[model samples]
Target: MPGSITGTIVDPTGAAVAGARVRISHGDQSAEQEALSGDDGQYSLPNVTPGPFQLTITLVGFTTQASSGILRSGENYTVPQIAMPLATAVTEVRVVPSRVEVAEDQIKAQEKQRVLGVVPNFYVSYDHHAVPLAPKQKFELAWKTTVDPVSFGVTGAIAGIQQAQNDFSGYGQGAQGYGKRFGASYANFVASTYIGGAILPSLLKQDPRYFYKGAGSKRSRVLYAIANSVICKGDNGHWQANYSSILGSLAAGGISNLYYPAKNRDGAELTFENTLIGISESAAVNLLQEFFIRKLTRNIPNYEPVSP
Candidate 1:
């Protein structure tokens, strides 16, 4: 007849300890045998040599436990349940960056992005899980964009084009006309950028930056880009109507009339038309951002998608 050893192991809380290893050694100094605890925390070593023995139970995250007993021939020796204490060794460490610090880092990376390393592309967030910008940070970004050298150069170029085309003839073709056009163009840029991208965004707690949707079918991406002209993410992370952008466009257009020649003033209907045109332009720009601009942009961050 052969003897066998059997027992159940448990945690200090009395819950069964699965996957525990039980090693048994005889008092005669014979070789040891091992068995693994089942889901029920029960372990059995069949045909164990009959004799006094010691059992050592061990698991990865639990303290080792031991028991000793004598076995009779042909008997099923069931030892008392073994209790294991949780291991005190350090297992894992996690360091979470502060939200403000994270947003600052993201802003630093975004500030480095420029089209062809020249034109600032500061209004788009490639990170889908980007943190919301603080009000002060929002104003800082608008200021940087307006004052970048390329902005002035672009405004000058636009004024030259308007001069060549004689778009605002009441100003008359001359150096004076160019200066007036340039001032008006730059004013338009500053007002719209501050009102929409900084002031309104801060007040409404809405995110003014366009969020890139990089993963989708071509048609879906295109539609999403276009839809973003009318909808934007709120600071609360929900999508809502883009009231800041729409109202900002209208306000900038209205303000432009005050500085432009009297003959060039936009009527109420024309002002609304220009607003629609601005929205359309936003859609077009978003489309380019989705499919084209990132490639041309320098120093963009390699952001990975995070789980919601």
Candidate 2:
């Protein structure tokens, strides 16, 4: 086929369909062509052989249509203009998205999707470029997680485990002892999450959520998730040192000294050690995020569709 078929395609409203798939077939064999319609509804399928053929047009969310005609050999055929009729009016209405508003709404929705249908999973945003939370919103999320009923229940469970394991033996074994351990565990979760995941992140204008980099080699994804612990996305949409995470871990550890048994409490050296431990914990969590959490999480939202 040394020649081509050239033509224009349009909808009833005369709007060019940019992504329309055009397929041509002749004889028992077939040939295919795809051309993006120009702004003015003009499209050209260069090097199409001169022959009798059929043009098949298709687009997503649209019905398929076809036209047949004969072409003279070596002819630059300008087929009759093809106008696609509206197949159906979909009742599904789509809203044009505003990026900032969409991110905010997504965050608000996530604040409600809890683990165990109770513990707030507010901090885990699926969006990589989520909008920065306002100061009040940050505290509100912290307060919500701190006071969640499941949080208290889980603290009791940990306290039970700790009692069985004699983890903080200085606290001793009794209802009173269990209460102390429970309080300490809950306090740790609250302090670390609020300081590292919320307050300092808000203050430093860093996103606390781990950005999922799903498209890459396994090694790259592993390194990306691990690197996220030390580097974070800033409000300026750039990567920088994760001051919020580092300082927050240290602050949470330092705050533990106020409640933990002195024997269990870290002196400044222990505080730094615990801070390192927290950073390591964050990397482990991010690794789980990269490979596991998305599967467990339900009702994952769709990304806003980018219209061409």
Which candidate wins on lDDT?
1
lDDT of 2 by residue, 166-187 (tens): 9878899999899999999998
Q: Please, what is the whole-model Cα lDDT of each candidate in the order they appear?
A: 0.91, 0.77
Tell me the lDDT of model 2 at 299.
57
TM-score of each: 0.68, 0.62
Please list the Cα RMSD from the true structure of every candidate, rounded to 1 decimal place.
9.6, 14.2
Clashing pairs in model 2, backbone N/Cα/C closer than 3 A: 3-48, 4-48
Candidate 2, after superposition: displacement of residue 131 in Å? 2.2
Decoy 1 TM-score against native = 0.68
Tens-place lDDT per residue, model 1, 193-297, is 999999999999889998988886889889999999999999999999999999989999999999888988999899999999999999999999999998899
Off by over 4 Å in 2: 1-103, 114-120, 304-308
